[model samples]
Target: MAQKNYGKKLLLVVLGSTVMGIGIYLTIIANFGSDPLTMFWIGLSNRLGITIGQANLLVSALMLIVVFFMDRKEIFIGSILNPLVISVTTDFLLRQTITIDSVGLRMMFFILGLLILAFGIAVYSLADFGRGAYEALVFSLNQLFKRSIRIFRILCDISFAIAGILLGAQLSIGPVMAILLMGVSIQFFINHLSRPIYHYLNK
Candidate 1:
């Protein structure tokens, strides 16, 4: 029974990570900007002349190092898989040239990307395998400082957004939308989607 449960959780982690990757890819192809972490990676990629996937892997690795010190308990197999899976999947999707000429269509894609991203987050959280590197950092900081997770998240996003901007990544509406909606979306998914799935799986 324990083995079965572990396998199920591992499967959920992979599924959630893959979905998140697709969402990330869609957001990137939408060309409306990206989430702060992604923006940071994109900025670094542009400045350092590396692929975005490479930048993502490098940044995630560095963040994981910090997470290792701050909260070793959060480290798990999922932690190792999250970054690699998301980056690789994003890179694969990005290889296809998906373009939208109309602003409305582009915005539609952007919104869809947000929904998918949120859903992925919700599913990933449900898996409860482990938090991703950036998320683990936020969780650890919250624990250390006794601050609300929301505040730390906002601060992280702002810092990354600014750094990305400074590095010559274009600022756009995508980050703003992500900041505003992601929390709400995650909550919605947790309450409405993941919990039910968890119940079903457990039963």
Candidate 2:
């Protein structure tokens, strides 16, 4: 069975990738303890004496390998495309040297980043082009347990935060708020956003 509207799916993947990258960059620059996975990345980087980028790659690769055995079908174009596109987008943005000085403004960026990140994740996940290693695990658990992804996602988020803390990553209000909201945010998009995307694709 051939997949229809694969080109559109790919577009979604790219858009999601770029959006996710921007979201990630914003969250990090906001500096409110960063995103959950990012907290873990920082911990891993410091623990291993490697660059943050190196730690990120290592974690993602290991995650991808795990998902590969868990459900290879979830490994698709987006799986590869997600990290590459996000890395490029974030790298470029980093070079821009974006900075926010206002506490209020930083908070705004964090909130916006969290929402956009979840939306981006939903867009690409709905595209059926596979998912990033982090999200692949989320959805894979959804399939395996036949439960709501929100529950699994919440657990995953908290677990990462705890691990990051254990590894010396500071916990803050921003990441804590994000940990609570991220799962709900992603599910919200999957619920609301999937309709239009799938509608366009099926047409």
Candidate 3:
């Protein structure tokens, strides 16, 4: 059997998603903006007469369409729950403020927030329950281009970020950091945690 059991995988998915939401909250708190995907959702929500949460739902729906065509299996499970979980979870957590009254405190939260996001994604992938929308799309692009996952991720993220910015999506320090750091962070955390965390979760 795979080292990670189904129950453990489910737990990790929820945990990872929760962390992703926290990271979004941190970006909002930092006042430094969020990633392109996030910015796109927020902007779409604002302009299209939808709540940010609802906008996220819409984005997930569109991505699921692409994902189903690109990799039917990967989209199969996540399509059912990942977007709904991420959208609702992020909205709830981000709405709850973690008040920080100082610049130093805010900066600290920013860095910590990034790390939390990394851990969440790492756990989510390590669990291997299903692929997140962004991750799945990057993997699909890599397969299509016959390129490395890392390289493809970087390229896609940059392209998406630029596009989101051009479309009047929020683009600032937090998002810039996310664009630069998310890939490396996810890679690092996944590599380091996959086996050990899986083993621990199973047992």
Best by lDDT: 1
| Counted clashes in each candidate structure | 0, 0, 0
Candidates 1 and 3 compared by TM-score, better number: 1
Ranking of models by TM-score = 1, 3, 2
Could you tell me the lDDT of residue 57 within candidate 1? Answer: 91
C-alpha lDDT (0 to 100) for residue 108 of candidate 1: 86
- Which scores better on lDDT, 1 or 3? 1
Tens digits of per-residue lDDT for model 3 on 89-112? 778876675777898888777777
Colliding residue pairs in candidate 3? none
* TM-score between candidate 2 and the true structure: 0.84
Using all chains and alpha carbons, the TM-scores for the candidates as numbered come to 0.95, 0.84, 0.84
Candidate 1 lDDT, 114-136, residue by residue in tens: 88988988888888888888898
Model 1 pairs in collision: none
In candidate 3 the C-alpha lDDT for residue 180 amounts to 79
What candidate 2 gets wrong by more than 4 Å, as runs, is: 1-4, 47-53, 139-152
Q: How many backbone clashes does candidate 3 have?
A: 0
